[model samples]
Target: MRNAPTVRFEAITQDNWEDCVKLEVKEEQRKMVAPNWYSIIQAAYDKTYTPLSIYHEDKMVGFFMYGKDPEDGLYWIVRLMIDKRFQGRGYGEAAIRLGLELIKRQEDCSPEIVISYVPDNEAAGKLYERVGFVPTGRIVEGETEARYKVLR
Candidate 1:
């Protein structure tokens, strides 16, 4: 198989919040997101979660928010959204693979990664499965979530 594209994650900042805010998800898909655009951007400022700007070739194309799950010892991918304009390319997969690589590099943690999304999101389910994440048969906070692990 061809190698996934390189992706870099930079911590989110106020200067880039607008770029994230303006990210468009199809109206039909908006229901899958939590807290809406305004709340998500607001939370980013408070540092409750860490937001990462996904970049490929110096272009900002996607955003993801995540934090460590203290209970499970897994890096939780809380939010991952590609700009509507940038969707359908391979950026999502590239970004996800890069995230997994980052987890592998964390010395404090082992290679367990977990992510959750609405069950109806077929595209996300397919992407996660494509990258080796299988359903963990677990639900969190009322959302159907799946878990995946990278073998050490």
Candidate 2:
């Protein structure tokens, strides 16, 4: 089998925003994550949030948004989703790892990184756990929260 394409993160820009919005999760997972268009729009109004597109080689395959929460002063990975066509190829994990690197590189980053998903999205829970996240035992807005403690 051929090796999987390299996964990398790119900023959601005006030139690539349309491609980013075109990415979609599987039908069964529609409720598990927000649509890219919604996320892009939200991020546009919130300067703290940075929306990014996940690319496999040169092709856009997913979308995620991360930033520090103004209300709590904590960093959060508020969104993550791989397109239906790219699921199960390890793109999600790679993207998260890269995202963590990006966040950790921030000079003012917090010691913990937070993420949440619909309580029933076992796949998301497993994926986050595999990357060192643990449940924080908090449910906000109907989603279960988990955190990755940033190691020094």
Candidate 3:
């Protein structure tokens, strides 16, 4: 079988904002990550949240947002979601890995990148652990905090 197409990231721009907001996680995952619309709104109103549109080839596949907690300088993945139509094809994994790469590129960024997930979201937990994030036994805004090292 031929390998899957590589994933690419495009910074969220007004030109394609509508396409990005249409991306959403599965219905069952509604609680895992906030809706892409919410993220887009946050990105617009929150200076720290930088949203990116994830694409495979030329089609949009997901959405990702991250930024530093300005007060503490802690890196944070504010949102990540594979479009319901694109779920279960490894797009989420590819998108997340790419997101991490972008975070690691930050100048003066924290050594540890942070993300939080609802405790009962096992799928999110597994995906995160599989990608090298480990639970810090910390909670932020009612979600469990997981951390990943980011130097490269």
- List the candidate numbers ranked by lDDT, top first: 2, 3, 1
Pairs that collide in candidate 1 are none
Backbone collision count in every prediction?
0, 0, 0
Worst 10 residues of 3 by lDDT: 1-10
The segments of candidate 3 whose C-alpha lies over 4 angstroms from its true place after superposition are 1-5
RMSD of each: 2.6, 1.8, 2.0
Q: Considering summed lDDT, which 10 consecutive residues are worst modelled in model 1?
A: 35-44
Error of 2 at 18 (Å): 1.0
- Reference-based lDDT, residue 111, model 2: 92
Per-residue lDDT tens digits of candidate 3, residues 14-131? 8898988777677788877888888888878988888889999999988888989988788898887888898778887777888888777777778899989999988888899989
- The CA lDDT of each predicted structure is 0.75, 0.91, 0.85
The Cα error of candidate 3 at residue 8, in Å, is 1.0
Instruction: Please report the candidate that would top lDDT against the real structure.
Output: 2
Q: Compared with the true structure, what per-residue lDDT tens digits does model 2 show for residues 1-152?
A: 54545788888888999998888888999988889999999999989999989988789999989999988888999999999998999888888988999999999899999999899999999999999999989998899999999998
Comparing 1 and 2 on lDDT, the stronger one: 2
TM-scores for every predicted model: 0.84, 0.95, 0.91
